[model samples]
Every structure is written in C-alpha cells, then in structure tokens.
Target chain A: MSASEIPVPQDPADALAAVVALRRLADQLEDAAVEQAMRAGWSWPQVAEALGVTRQAVHRKHAKRLIAAGVKLRRRSP
Target chain B: MSPIDAYLHTVIMEAATEARRQGSATIEAQHLLLAVAAQEGTAPQRVLASAGLDYQAVLAALDREFDHSLSAVGVSRAAFNLPRPSMPSKRPPDIGATGKLALERAFASAPRKKDLRPAHVLLGILQAEVGTVPRALALAGVDRADLLNRVRDAIAGDGVE
Candidate 1:
C-alpha cells in the first residue's frame, strides 16, 4: 500500500474492528491528557471544561482512578 | 466465593473499567494484564511488582508504546493536540477477539470447580499470543519467558509463602 493511500476495510468486520481500535486510542490520549492536566494543577472543572464535559462527569470518571494512582487532586471549595 | 474467584472478577472488572477510561471500544489482553498488575496485593500483582511492573510502570510502558506507534505514523504528541472524541451513546464497549480468547483460555486453564486466579489469567494472556501486552512488557524490559516462569511459580504456590 502507498503511504498516501488509506486502505478501505475489505469487510464489515474489518470496518468495525478499525472503529474499536480508533476509539481505544482516543481514550488513551484522553487519559494521558487528563493526567497531565491534573499534574499541572488543573482542577476537575477546568479539565472538564477543556474537554467540553461537566465537572461531575469528568470527576465521576477519573477521580477514583487518579486517587488510586496517587495523583494529587486539589480540593473543590463549595 | 473463593478468594481466587473474587480476585479474577476484580481483574476482569477493572480491565473493563480501564478499557472504558482509555476510550477503547474493545477489552484487550493488555488491559487484563494491566488490571492484574494494578490490583494491589494479589499474587500476580506482587510478581509483577517485583519486576517493576506496577501500575505506574505499566502506564509508562504503554506511553512508550503509544509514542512509538505515533512515530511510525510520522506524528508526535508534541507535534499536535489529540482531539478528545466522545462516545455517541452510553452503551459500554465490547471485548475484542483477542480479549475474548484470553478470557476463554483463562477459564479453561482454571482448575475445575475452583476459583480462577490471576496467574491463570496471566497464563491465558501469554498463551493467546495476541494483543499489546507482550509488546508493552518487552518495551518495559521484561523477559517474557522469565515472567511466565515467575507467574507459574506463583500459581504453583511458591510466591504466596
């Protein structure tokens, strides 16, 4: 295959497989970015806003994992 | 339920959670391997930890793998920002073929009517010979054969003592 040519999937299975793989890669990038943001002292709301998500949604997804991984999180003042 | 059963469930559940967190639509063997390494105090966890393959270590290994993969495509994380794509629906992603194979092998390898342990899952992963776990472990300077031996040792009731 040529470098400039993107190969089309030969079958439905191939197409679906590609979609799954691409989504996984996206998730990995998101996780990496979120971790970097937290490491740089960004709050949950800030990170969520950057990703166009609500604070609750982002926090609900990542907070526990971040804590378990020993990423220091800033307190959100009420 | 036996402790082994509980631990295997934890590993599988954590692997699913990890897949979702990473935006992966399929659960791969690599994710299961990571879940085993991250579950603290488990036999597989201890074995991996002794080889410096803890959660952070595995993450670092994965980062390197991602970097290498991007470089292969002539892109770099430093070159551009990665877009954060959201899933269109709330439905969870399904397990991939390699992951399904590994899980089946894990069950087969498990002693009949006994709890399935992390070591069994680890062995299953190795046996599948697919997915990114082996590559990531290699990137982390882990000798696959040696690690396999250690995991077997743990399963044989050596490391728990």
Candidate 2:
C-alpha cells in the first residue's frame, strides 16, 4: 500500500500501541524469513544483504538460534 | 534468600518462559502478569481468578489486544500465512522496560521490602494505565480500577495472616 493510503489510529495510545505491535510483528517475520532463507541454502552474506544489514551483524544475531534449530548453514560465500 | 525474593525469582523465570513461548525476546509486563496468573495458591493468582482472568483467559486477552493494536493500523495478522517461528532456546529472555517498571511499582506498593508479597506484583501490573495490560483488560470488559481495588484488598487480607 502507498504511504498516503496507510490508515492512522485516532487515539494516541492506539497509535503508539500499533507501533509496538508492528515492530514485534516485523521482528517475528524477520526471524521466520531468515530461517526459511537459510534453510533454503542462502548464505549469511546474502541474507544480511537482503535485510540491509552487515553479515557480521546478522550472523551475531541469528547464528546461534539457527544452529540450534539445526539449519544447515553455508559456512562461507562461494 | 528471603521468601519474597525467592518468589519473585520464580515468577520472573516463569515470565521468561512465557516470553519465549510467544517468540518474544524480552519478558514484558504482560508476561509477568501471565506468570502471576499461572502461579496457583497465591493471593495474586486467586485475585486474578476471581476477576475471570485465569492464565488461559489472560492469554486470550493478550492475543486479542495484539490483534486489536494491529488493526488500529489497518493491518491484519491473519493476512500473513507464515508458519509459527521456532523459539530460540539458547538463552532465556531478559526483562524488558515494562517488566522492570512493573516490578518497581510492585516493590513500591509495599512500604518496605520486608512487606513484599506476590499480590504486590499484581498491583504493580494493574497500576499501569497506558500499556498492553490495561488495554487488554479493558478490551476484555474488565474494570481496571475495580481489579486494582480487589488486588489491594487481597494484599491487605494477606497482611492479617
């Protein structure tokens, strides 16, 4: 949807809460998307680049969880 | 450790578990509230139950609040068809800002640390006026003021014992 088409909450409390909920939803989506990409053989650099972040940053954030989940991660870029 | 300290630690640990179960990275006030509701035989738990806010009911209320908040921005969580993400099990979630605030309020509710009780924690959470807990309770048709009074009464009754 266009920015102009986005709906705004009438109440400030509702608006603030929407921001919190949206951030949480975004975080959950990122975790699921990153896991899905890694499981599908995407490298750390590739996922990081797609997410507009540094490879080291992404790796630090998700490597342990992904490893624990047993996703076969690519060690390095080809 | 004192009994109150032990109890708070147990509650925080349980809140961390609840946070992880919901894929959260930090234990917030709502998680603490859920932990309080789940702790059977506690005055806080009894008070919550008397308000129709057992663990499951609280969970439902929280879920409804999430949906309602998202709807405020015209977004529907149902529109997303992604599977539930796997929980990160490497480390337990640390307490977040709201959780810390609730604990602080709980501690402040009693005149002294030696007077701390589980019901004080519930009072702390109930005292938040502009957060997920209040919003969820309101959406669930709960009277926040009445609940606060009930929690206060519970705490008072505990002091007599």
Candidate 3:
C-alpha cells in the first residue's frame, strides 16, 4: 500500500495524533480477542502463543481483567 | 520507520500478533490501547480492576470507539498482518519481576500466545492499582467505558470522544 493509502498524519502534530489513534484502535481489537480467547477455554500460554508475545508480558498485562471478570481460563484437556 | 513509526510498528505488530493468537478474527482499538498500557508498564489493567470497573462494559465502549475509527480506515480484525512465534525474544521482558510474572501468567493463561495482545496491557493497568487511582476513579464513578472512550479518543486524536 502506498503511504497515502494508510491513514497518516498530514502534519507532525497530526501524525502524532494519528499514531495515538491507531494505538487505541489496536488496543481495543487486542482486548476483544483476549476476552474471546479466555471465554473459549484458552490458557495464558495458549493466549500468549497465539498473541506471539511472551507469556509474562501477556499475564502482567491481562491477568487481572480475567480475574476481575471471573472468567476462568479453560485448562487444556490432558 | 520514523521514531514514531518504530514505536507504532512495534505496537501494531504486537497487536496483530495478539489478534492472531486470540483468534478473534480482527484487531481493534482496545488491543492497541492494551499495548500502550503494557508497552513500558503504564499500568492500566491494575488500575481498572482495583476500581471495580466492568470488563465487558469497558470492552463495549472500546468497540464503539473502534467502529468509529474503522469507518475511517476500513477493515475488520483479520485481513492484516500475522507473525508466527519463533524463539522467544532475546531482550528481557519489559515489566518488573512482579509485572513480568503477571505477563507470563497472562500468556500462560491464554489458549494461544496471540491472546496476550497490547490491549491486555491497558486493561492490566486498570486492574493493577487497586487503591489509589482505581479507587479514586471508582469513587468518582469512573468505569472502563470512560477509560475506553478516553483512550480511543486519545488514539484517534478526537480528544476523549
């Protein structure tokens, strides 16, 4: 895709703003997916593996929400 | 990539990776927000839970914000980038020991590593601090929806819409 195709900031300040906007969009999408994964009987490692980040990064960032939501991670079937 | 692009690239790539891991079929605003929170340990998840904010409620608000942006950009969560997990990163994980543990658990808890996207980072911050800011937000009637919107606007440059 060309530079124009993607939503970029026209000015430096605007560019910064666009970055921020993109970041938020990225977060929302990430959270929804994580929520879905947890509900679907996924483990943290499973989630981490899917997310492609370290297990620790995912846990430190997401565990509390799952805990708060009372959504238990589905243990892998042995 | 410019400095901004470098950061954005890392954050976006992270989100895309997470989206694929979670198998949600699309990347949205919260995912990006989560990364922002977790990027350098902004601590949004801890703040959210301690304040007693509803997770779904916050997710809903974030959805609205994302829809608004997607209308501008066009596309759902999938049909974007998806990087496979190779070996673990050489660099140490970002957060402190406790924080690192939390992240590891988050990943371990997931069905896939994709589950631990950047949005988790933001949500984690909300839950991190149980007493100070989260408490204050709770007393003041703040919730995840409010945070979601603020975060959405902050990202979109809409200024807390």
Candidate 4:
C-alpha cells in the first residue's frame, strides 16, 4: 500500500505498534544502505557526508557493526 | 548427480571460484547471489532475474555501489584502477559466516531433505537478517517482502525444476 493509503493509528496501542514497526524498518533500511555503501568501498567520512552526519558519529555507530559482520572496510587517506 | 550434490558442485563451486577470482579469502553472500544469477533454468536464478538482479545487472550494481562509496570519499574511478590479484586455488575457498548461515537457512527451509532447491536458498537469502544479499537487493530497489511472496507462490503453484 502507498504511504497515503496507510491509515493513521486511532488507538494508542496501534500507534505504539506502528512506532515499533517503523523503527524496526528504519533500522533495517539504514543497516542495508550502510552495508551497501561500505561494500561499494566508501570511506566512513564519505558515508557520513552522505548521511549528513559527522564522520565520527557515523563511524562510532557503524564501524564495529560492519567489522563484526565481515564487511571489508577500508580506511582511505582523508 | 543428486539434486543436492549437483547444486553443491555447480552453484557452491561457482561462488567459490568467483571469490577466488576476486582475491577474496572467503565466499560471501554476494558471490553466492552472483552464482545464482549466472545459472539458467533454476528457480532462484529466475526470481533474481525477474527482480532485475540478473548476472550483469548485479555485477554493475556491485561496481556502482563501490564506485559511489569511493566517490563519497573523494575518490573516482578515473583516479586509479586497483588490480585484483587472483588468489592461488590450492583448495576451494571456505564459505564465510554469512554464506554458511544462508546455506543452513536454505536447508532448514527445504520441505524434504532430498528436495532441497534453489528457491529455498533464494528464500533463505531474502530472509537473511544480516549479509550482503539483503543489502544488495535493497540497493537494487527490490521489495524483499514482495520477492518472498512471489517465491512462495512459485513454490506452491509449480514445483521447482
């Protein structure tokens, strides 16, 4: 269904569930996008810039996760 | 060859060879996907092709992703070409954790031990919570849920060859 087609949650419980599900989907999207960028050989700074976050912020958030996931991350000379 | 053994000999070995060609030590999900896309007349290959993740498209997507990432870091393809040294194939390359999990999941999703098929592996890869398969599919603009539903329909509607 289109975003416009999605009915707004009327009940508090429904709203809460919507929020949780949205968060999970958002997490998956971010993770997938980041992993794609990394696999493409983008540096942390580049990813940070693309995401409009500081290099440190992006790196802090994703460095360990990418490493643990076995993504071949490389540090480019800035 | 038995279905399972044939799959292992062909698909798995092709992925391993791709990894070796790329100078990677471990066979990854992306390589496996590439292998699936390369094969003809298979359920997984058909699904991937229908989703626009066919062999050449996937290769281009991977290259584009890498180039895009590098460009973000102020690098460009025009700047330099990195040589990919082929690793010596002393033995078959080992499957990485992600690839292993995908295989395990594929087996688990199979209806019967003797009936393992590429569609199950495709479903497994789609359902993979972590790994290059999901990430690459997302980058390719595929709807994972839709792909999963179609695969299910294919399995139920017609038995995979």
Candidate 5:
C-alpha cells in the first residue's frame, strides 16, 4: 500500500498495544493456517495461491519451523 | 503480569538508574537506549568500547544530545516533540519549581548563580563524576558528542520535527 494509504493513526501507546496484539494474532493465524494446509496435503504453491500470495513469499515467512514439533506458541487468552 | 510489559519495566528501571548514575541532568533517549544495551549485556558494549565510545564517551554524547535538543526545538525544551516510544523518561520528570529550587541548593557548592536552568543543573547530576549514564551510553556505542548530535537532529531535523 502507498504511504498515504495508511491512516494517520491512533494514540501511539494505544496503537502500540494494538499492533502487538495484532502481531500475536497474525502469528497464530499464519501458524494454524500453514499447519492445517500442510496436513491437508497441499504443496507450498497451492497454499500460497489460496492465500493470494507467491509461494516463495509464504515459504520465506514460515519455513523456519525450528521447533522439535511438540512446542507451539500460545494464543491470547480468550 | 503481561510478559512483555514486565520485560519492558526492567528495561526502564535500569535505564533510569543508569541515567542517575551518569549524573545526566535529564533522562534523554540516548540514556534509555544505553540502558537497554546495558541490560541486554549484549556484545554491543564490547564493540562500542573498542570504537572509543567508553562509558565516559557515551555520557558525554548524551549530554550534548540534551543541549542540542534544547535550542534545536523551534520553541524551547518545554516545546520539544519527543519520539513517542521515547517517553516515561528514565528519571522522574518532575521539572516543576520545587525541582528547580532543590537543584539550586544541590549546586550551592559550585561557583554559579543561585538559579540554574534545567540543562545547567541537570548536567550537574549526569556528569562523568556521578551517574552511570555515560557508561550506559558507551555500552550503546555512543558517546556524549554523538548523543548531542542525535538530540540536535531529532529536534531540528525535517519531517519528523
């Protein structure tokens, strides 16, 4: 998006908290989406298309699945 | 406690105490960053020290930051535009009359006037002799001259101002 496309924004402190929250949410969503996509036998390209992005972009963002597969980041408390 | 907030507070307090130690009359952003570097105990300190930005050098930089910020502002120090994340000051910002009065007496040992401007007296506290501020700045790879330059540019620079 263009720079002007961005809104002038909210109170910075409030905006910062919201940004942090949203970032946490984005991570959870991306993680779940990728895991489920992989489980459904979708290739990176297929998942990338479904998410409306290039395969390389999607892979680069999440390919570093560094854990031993048992650990996961916790979601925000409901 | 929220994990991040707790982490941030530890950072804030460390910066504040360092500011006090450096005898930096004010809690400027350089001190805060220096404090963060100090708390991180990151490799940056060693790197900076090798670059000639030892603790004393960094504090000297921060002092300059404070001075430049004062006049670089279109108005005055009171009318400065601080970067938002750079708030809550490393030190308690009770810059009112009582604070000023206390400062005068604190500096009574000097050969100066009875009244001191905010910069004049605050410098008194954060100088190399007292606070760990200089040390903290050095840890951040900055010295007094650089800190002063940052403060100057921050206040007088283009769009951000």
Candidate 6:
C-alpha cells in the first residue's frame, strides 16, 4: 500500500491506540509464524534471517514455548 | 499478612493469569481491572457490576477496543487466519508499567496504608484517563466518570464499616 493510501486516525488517542493494537498483532503474528516455520523443519538460522533478527534473539524468545508445544525443532545450523 | 495485602496478592495473581490467557508479555492495567471485576462478592466487583461491567462485559469491551483500534489503521484481525499460538511456558507475566501505575494510584488514594481497601485498586484503575481500560470503557457506552464516582463511593462506604 502506498503511504498516501494508508489510513491514519484523525484523533491522537485513536492513532496511539492503533499503535498499541498493531504491536500486539505483530507479536501474536511472530509467535504463530515462528512456530509454523519451525514445525515445517526450518532451522533456527533460517527463521532468524527471515525475521531479520539474530538467531540467539529469536531462540531466546521462542525456543522454550516451541519446545513445550512439541514441535520438534532442528539442531543449530553450522 | 494484612487483609488488604492478601487481597492485592490474589488480585495480582489473577491479573497475571489474565495476561497469560491473552498472550500478553506483561500484566497491564486492563488485566488488573479484569481481575477486580472477576473477584466475587467484593465491593469493587459489585460497583463494577452496578455499571454493567462484569468480568465478561469487561472482556467483551476490551476485545471490541482491540478490533476498533486495529480498524483505525485499516487492518482487520479477521484477515489473519492463523490458529492461536501456544501459551508461553515462561514465568507468569510481571506487572507492566500501566499496572504499576494503577497500583501506585491505588496506594496513593488512601489516607494511609492502613486505610487501603480493595476498592482503592479499582479507583486507581479507573483514574487513568487514557489507555486500554479507559478506551474500552468508553466504547462500551459506559460513563467512566460515573463509574469512578461509584467506586469512590464504595470505598467511602467500606471505610465506615
């Protein structure tokens, strides 16, 4: 979508609230997307690169939750 | 522990659970408000219910607020067809900034620590003029000022008992 086409809330409160809601949506999306990628046999490095974050950062964030979810994760990439 | 201390602990614990259920990384003011509304037979709960804000109502209002806020940016949550993510196995979410602010306001509302009651916590949450709780209350067609007055009255009546 073009910058001009993007909707911006007129009210400052509404705009701020949209930021909060978008952050929450992003977090939820990341969790779901990471899990889906891992379950599909994607390596940690691959997922990290895809997310434009460090492997350690991604692992620290999601490894435990993914493990508990019983999605067998691949070993660390060489 | 003092009665108020114990009550605050239970409410915080319930709020943590609410945070976890909502997949939030921290327990926010909204979660604390939900905890207050869910607590059975409390003066605060009664006060909230009087304004048609039971626990379920609060949850519904918050959900509506989330959707409404997203729509403001031209995004629809229904477009995301992914299944809900698994619950995080980490420790219960700690109290976030908004939650701490509410508690601070609650503590400050009383004349002294000894005067503090459960209703004071609700007062603190209601005192916030912005953020998720206030926005949700507004969108739900509830008069926040009226609710705040009711909570204050409840606290005052409890003091006389």
Best candidate according to DockQ: 6
Stretches > 4 Å off in candidate 6: none
**What's the TM for chain B in candidate 3?**
0.31
Best by lDDT: 6
Model-by-model DockQ, in order: 0.08, 0.79, 0.05, 0.02, 0.01, 0.86
> Candidate 1, residues B28-110: lDDT per residue as tens digits?
78788789888887777888887888898988887776665544444456764654433322345578777888889877976
Off by over 4 Å in 2: none
Q: What is the C-alpha lDDT profile of model 2 across B73-107, one tens digit per residue?
A: 99899998876667776598888999999999999
Candidate 3 vs candidate 5, lDDT winner:
3
lDDT of each: 0.71, 0.91, 0.48, 0.68, 0.43, 0.93
- lDDT by residue (A22-74, candidate 3, tens digit) is 66457655666777777778888888888899988987766666666677766
- In model 3, the runs with Cα more than 4 Å from the true position are A1-4, A75-78, B1-161
Residues B1-161 of candidate 4 have per-residue lDDT tens digits of: 78767876788889998776654557877778788789898877888788877899888765554444333334454553333222333457799876888788778887777767667777776777543455456667778889888887767665545
Per-residue alpha-carbon lDDT of candidate 4 for residues A3-50, written as tens digits (9 for 90 to 100): 776556555543543453344334445656777788889888889899
Summarize candidate 3's per-residue lDDT along B1-161 as a digit string, tens digits.
Answer: 45434554676566555444433334434444344534553333434444443444444444444444444455454554433222222222333332343344434533454334434444344443332223334444676467754443333342212
Report the lDDT tens digits of candidate 6 across residue range A29-67.
999999998988999999999999999999998999999
Recovery fraction of native interface contacts for candidate 3:
0.06
RMSD of each: 8.8, 1.2, 18.0, 12.3, 20.2, 1.2
What's the candidate order when arranged by decreasing lDDT?
A: 6, 2, 1, 4, 3, 5
Candidate 2, residues A1-78, lDDT tens digits: the string is 899788989899999999999998998898889999998899999999999999999998788888988889999987
Classified by CAPRI criteria, candidate 2 counts as medium
Give lDDT: candidate 4, residue B46.
85
TM-score per candidate, in order? Answer: 0.64, 0.97, 0.34, 0.60, 0.26, 0.97
- Residues B1-161, candidate 5: write the lDDT tens digits: 55334544554465556644543334444454454345333333433444565556556665554433222222133443332111112334323232334234335523444222222222332333212344344434545565443333332332221
